[model samples]
Target: MPCQSSEELNVLVKEAREFTKDGKVADYIPALGRANPHDLSIAIQYPDGQCISAGDIERKMSLQSISKVISLALVLMDRGPSYVFDRVGMEPTGDPFNSIAKLETSSPAKPLNPMINAGALVVTHMIKGNSIDERFQRLLSFIRELGNDATIQYSEEVAKSEFNTAYLNRSLSYFLKQHHIIQEDVEELIDLYTRQCAIEMNCLELARIGLIFAMDGVDPDSGKQIIPVHIARICKTFMVTCGMYNASGEFAIKIGIPAKSGVSGGIMGAVPGKFGIGIFGPALDEKGNSIAGIKLLELLSKNYQLSMF
Candidate 1:
């Protein structure tokens, strides 16, 4: 496949930036509300190591729910798929990211999948460590290893803010406890989950991590296996089925790639050995996906033939 020239990518970035005008920054999280709605950036890394980026590709942002994929992968690696699956199901719920309706009605009360807030909280509890700091450090290490960036760290402001306002997540954690789903203390697990979501990185760093998924859990540039092949497959499957909150199906139809979006207006997309795309636009649509980021991915997928489907 021919690589896109920097000039061509720049033009596409400019076109995608227009979408931010139609969307608004996520205001529910006060920390996230401070982002510039018009901020948009993109970075693409090819299997052979070619890199192209446009706009504010270096601007840092919180990982938000995007960290769920990594947390799921880490838990699967530490405790096999059977153990992880026993705690969280793989089915997608067509509801919002934090919906608890299913928990009240679903027979087993397990979370539908790890992409949603409830499911991610369960996965975070499953992470192996003695203390919250230890678990968070382990998670940060895994992300840095996959991204080949050693500077990734948790944003204190984001973590503290989320910790203070995570009422829905707290309710979900307690509900999971009532059902014997969560094995850890509810407060501890919620803190762990919130900290994971607060991990920060830019599009370039995120693109590197996405490339590992594109290469089936192996770091393409270094040929190091960071995540197991089976776990990688499972993660990609969930990304396709439930990564975009309730809009996962629509994103699959339009973008046709395994991807995940964060409330902080970041997206990580894997194209299975072809390319990895990272996009950021703080403004989001009703479903909590970055509007401009989604547009950029759709255009890039069509133009580059990067869809996994």
Candidate 2:
């Protein structure tokens, strides 16, 4: 039943690409706009070390919002979930990824979930470091470990592009500061957050990260515990509830997997006890998930009955 065969996956990926017409590339970041919106690819790896890939398989893109998954785990491992959750909440905001409106409205003013910009800024402030550079370096180091590859690092060009025009994220940081959720320099945290988002990797590397979660914090291939089991469970829960931005509920209802999607049009999915799936489809739906990627996952989950639900 494993469709790791290249021919089977190639046909499936081609079929999924038709859905790309329903979405658009995230040009608001300008640098991300350069992604060939027409590009669509997928990679799925199971715990046994088998892999399935189709189309643009080697293409690299920034982690974008998907970096939040690592940041949340790092904070939980560093300060414990009790401390981290006190600063942020576990619930989904049901608002847009960058919605500042949620700040003024939510009680106690904690960013709803770490997946959103406001919440991610709060976690970035909590990362231990003497300077912005130190913090991001630590984060990048952790991310590289998750990917199980030393060569992965932040995309300097993408970081510069996002930092120069990150007006919305800047606003979110100031709002968190005002709410007392972030007690540090706004610009420093913003720089850390922006650079973290620019960490670049391809689908194969992403599958490694996802497999760590699927294996409950242990790297299935290496047998090393990358994070604590409890922390990994919390992250997986957030992915099920908030990973796809506002469309999280729909994604869960359909795909029923713990996954995270970035504005750069990359999605990382962990199928518990089964496989780690990585997808890149630059065209995104209204809620910011990859259009073709979501469709492909739907096809996979349905045909293979991979949904957890």
**Global lDDT of each candidate:** 0.88, 0.88
TM-score of each prediction: 0.97, 0.97
- Count of backbone clashes for each model? 0, 0
Q: Local error of candidate 2 at 35, Å?
A: 1.1
Which digits, one per residue and each the tens of the lDDT, describe model 2 over residues 1-309?
Answer: 233547878888999999988889999888899888889988888888888889877899899988999899998998998999998888886799999887888889888889888888888889988888888888888988888788998888888888899899888888878878888887777778889999999998898789888888998867888899999999999999999999999999998999999989999999997889888999999888899999999998888898898
Error of 2 at 234 (Å): 0.3
